[model samples]
Target chain A: MATIQHPYLLFLGDAPDQLAAKTANGVKVWRPEWCIGQFRLPGCKADLGLPDVSIEEAAAQGAKTVILGVANRGGFIPESWIVELVKALGLGMDIASGLHTKITAIPSLKDAAERNGRKLFDVRHPSRDYPVASGKPRPGKRLLTVGTDVSVGKMFTTLAIEKEMRARGLNADFRATGQTGIFIAGEGASIDAVIADFISGCVETLAPANSEDHWDLIEGQGSLYNVSYSGVTLGLIHGAQADALVMCHEIGRPHMRGLPDYPVPEIPTAMDTILHMAKMVNEDVKFVGVSLNTSNVSADEAAAFKAKTAEQTGLPVVDPLKDGVAPIVDRLLAG
Target chain B: MATIQHPYLLFLGDAPDQLAAKTANGVKVWRPEWCIGQFRLPGCKADLGLPDVSIEEAAAQGAKTVILGVANRGGFIPESWIVELVKALGLGMDIASGLHTKITAIPSLKDAAERNGRKLFDVRHPSRDYPVASGKPRPGKRLLTVGTDVSVGKMFTTLAIEKEMRARGLNADFRATGQTGIFIAGEGASIDAVIADFISGCVETLAPANSEDHWDLIEGQGSLYNVSYSGVTLGLIHGAQADALVMCHEIGRPHMRGLPDYPVPEIPTAMDTILHMAKMVNEDVKFVGVSLNTSNVSADEAAAFKAKTAEQTGLPVVDPLKDGVAPIVDRLLAG
Candidate 1:
């Protein structure tokens, strides 16, 4: 099997008018790059898990894809994000996600995933996980879930997937995590306290599946990689012991707004975000795929962008919508 | 003061590109009736709030001028923002806010308060009463403070103000809000949540002075009213709540790069931001100014942008570094 690109993309935004047109003579113009920019998700406080925490710690914990979710005011989510993910995954890839949303429907998401033979383990919600050393009985595969609860958008997406899977004569179990968080930006004693509480809280509701590995990792977020606000690089690499990676991006217009004053936004175009996440998580890896968020944008736009985006990033755009998401798992198996 | 004709203007950036050139295009011009579609800002989510909850809430509560706080990564705080605010205040005009940030030191922040015949309040990181009803035995005048730990550029900008003010002989106390927040959506439950916490937890620590009633407003933030995300109306009637208002903006070459798809590689322009904030904040009371964030862009390009941005917005170009931030604040105060 050929290699698959890592999945995971972070979409950022400046705004609509800013995204739509710029004044050449005090008039506006529609920019083509707006598509790529929209996919570059900024770090969200709600999703403050990225950019605020350490990448190494997250990668260490078997967390490869770190979601940079897009939470904008207007109802705007693009299909390009999932398309970007699928193309990056190569022909067949299996992966989890850095991005989760109840905004998009689940049936649609599943169809999108299956179209490509890719498998998306739709643990769309975030739940708490107990440390294996707690000496308590553990939950199984459920321990690797990302969110404590599927967001309003993610929850909707999961339910739709279940209904559609059943209608299509497919067997599936849609899962949701029941953990909540009180975010604390600290390390050493403080982080331990926060992490212990966070994990314990998750366990109270959902037992860490016996699948919870013996060893785990903690990741940092934000530009201050060593500081709090961890982005989940180490947990995926160290804990998941990833053979490859993929970052999920919403893939839309806002991702391209560059803040000159801030240096972090300077490095990655939406395309670069996918490559960088893969690099940050694994010291050695050749390619990766991305999950394009295709909730609001048109399919033509998504496909056109997928091709352009993939070509630019040197990774083929994987249509998570067309290809089943599990193929990414195959990459893990191949690795 | 005779009311200024076309007292209001709107700045819009549909996308980013050679903005200076766009504003400079030689063609039949059409002036916008209320809002503008030109100019942009040099700031991002870092400046407003990120990672921290209180700061995000503060942005929603304190925006006395317009939703400048809500522009997020789209634009800079237009120099006109301060300019108009100062002019209006000194001249005794009505005002309000759409975002969450400090005032007074900027001048327009003092809502009709006078100290020895001059505006008593300076743009100190002043705390205002957040309208949150807590479950505690309440003292009407008890102090409530909300801290904003901003991002790299923002923390630096905040620190710069401290340094500049102190260097120039101002005695001020600035406490770190610990960390900043990245994404604040609207002035709804999310924003209210953090501010409510501040009202509950920080009352004891604030130790309000008996004479604190001298001040009457909070600051500006993003979630309260941004064009896309939060939907704070950009129209003057629906914008800021200041007696008068001033907006500050950075004008540059990244013109059509207003929207997301295009990443002009130039730092996000600040033109559309200033105008948008200005329009949202007020139409009549004050003059607008420009603080081109020329720090990163080439001097040739930056210098080349001045006339175009000013002419486009119909606001005076004020250099924030040279003219001082006070004049703009004074505009918002009806002295």
Candidate 2:
């Protein structure tokens, strides 16, 4: 790699929240900012205020480079985003799996990114679809799922949290298969059918996503689709599609009580909650990551929560801004 | 494994279209009739129509589940709709990811869903502040940001497209992260920021979803979220986001001969368009998976385009929906 220079790195993405944390030589830096975007399905009457962004815009911001972060959940951010990322960011965009949109966008984006001084990075280590090549699924292995809640910034903080652990060195990964909750269909699809469908759907996704030493980091944002910025995907209810199980709390309320007394919820503590969920998803939770939302909690509180989590979970907690993420990535990578 | 009755499986969501074939055995269905309620983002001028329900609803509805479907886009959808889903659909009610409305509603929702034999499926993933275990970053091996636009059904149909391949044994887990489109968010953070903020301020929304899977057979009457349907989410954008992506022919008068009808610019043959983008992104384009809008092109045309791609790149040209998503995921997972 021609000895890449410039220690400080900021991953600008349409999903700024997902790209939180400033990094330098494997250490954390200034407040990590995550990009949060809200969108609505065309022709639909609702507006889902979620966290996401285009790879192009992410790169366009002119950072050393930008990372295309995907939800560990089996889905995509539109082929257009990937295509844009290739021409915008360097170090490339990382795809969770080459299933739906990524399959189409990444490849196209690979070529685009190459020309733009960037490239596409595949994050799906052992795809479930490639059975012969994939190793068996093992809990507490390399990959894991760290569930999260609403609040784009929190999600970003959580998603970008690998730096701290990496700074120390650990074997872990988060399975971010977008929020997993109840899904519904107007038709008469039964619950068992729904559960089975949910299971199978997720299996189909994470199965191909199967990998060794890999863990999951799922998010259970309150109130899935149809509701404001809270709810699960429609796919969850139809097929058995939850491989990265997540547990979240509803924070998308207005003037809610017990909060830090701000528009945003208390993030640091919220992260502590997800750490517990990480254990439930995988008992031996090797390492932990958190997603903080400044809008919700104070930076100090977020930092304090980090220490508390380390004390409670007995697992190293990472804050992308304070700790570089490369070290954490190394720990998660197979030797 | 104790012959696990339900397996309590988890799906890595992806495309709903391709999942139709994949979900036959284990289905993941979304209410094709649902809609998000978004007027405009707190900063941006776009909308996001997300889903609203819980994991409990999926279990009850009997959706086998597949990859990320649309509906989850959080932009607009009356908050009351969520109440209806919780009250009527039971497991059908879910929450979007952005904003604070739903996150704050969790405590009360537990009662509503539990009383109806459903679970809220909370959101609690790791944050950027997650403490490190083994003193390492433990960055997950991958990241995915999945979503869609054009409404819930289109998002569902477009996102679920991995099915045709899954039936062939491709594991394309879908995860719906709602929607995040360019045309949706303007370049300026001022307006965009406001829209984004307003979106964050939102929560506890309602979007009644309806899926378009093979079993559900939602053919003629499309979703209430589609342009065909009388949805305001699309109107909110004033044809900016979607229109920007559109290509047209310089035919005549105030509007020329439109496009879709005469097929002048012809939406640029998939191969030609991809190749153009490929050159812009990278030069060494090899494998590619094309999911053509069958609704727009004919079998012969699609075949011809695929043939052209193969001839031009000398790499594998796979049809995402038909070929399944396994090969693509396999390549990304290569050691």
Give model 1's docking category. Answer: incorrect
Compose the digit string of candidate 2's lDDT tens values, residues A99-181.
22343244565555555554332322212221111112233333232223233332333345333443456443333333111
Position A79, candidate 1: lDDT: 56
Top model by DockQ, which number? Answer: 2
For candidate 1, give the lDDT: 0.28
Candidate 2 error regions (>4 Å):
A1-138, A141-149, A152-154, A176-214, A218-252, A255-335, B1-335
Local accuracy of candidate 2 as per-residue lDDT tens digits, B67-138: 111222243324443453344325343332222134325555557656755433212111112110111111
User: What tens digits encode model 1's per-residue C-alpha lDDT throughout A177-259?
Assistant: 21111110000111111221132222223222334322111121111111111112122222222223343344443421221
Task: Give the true-contact fraction for every prediction, in order.
Answer: 0.00, 0.02
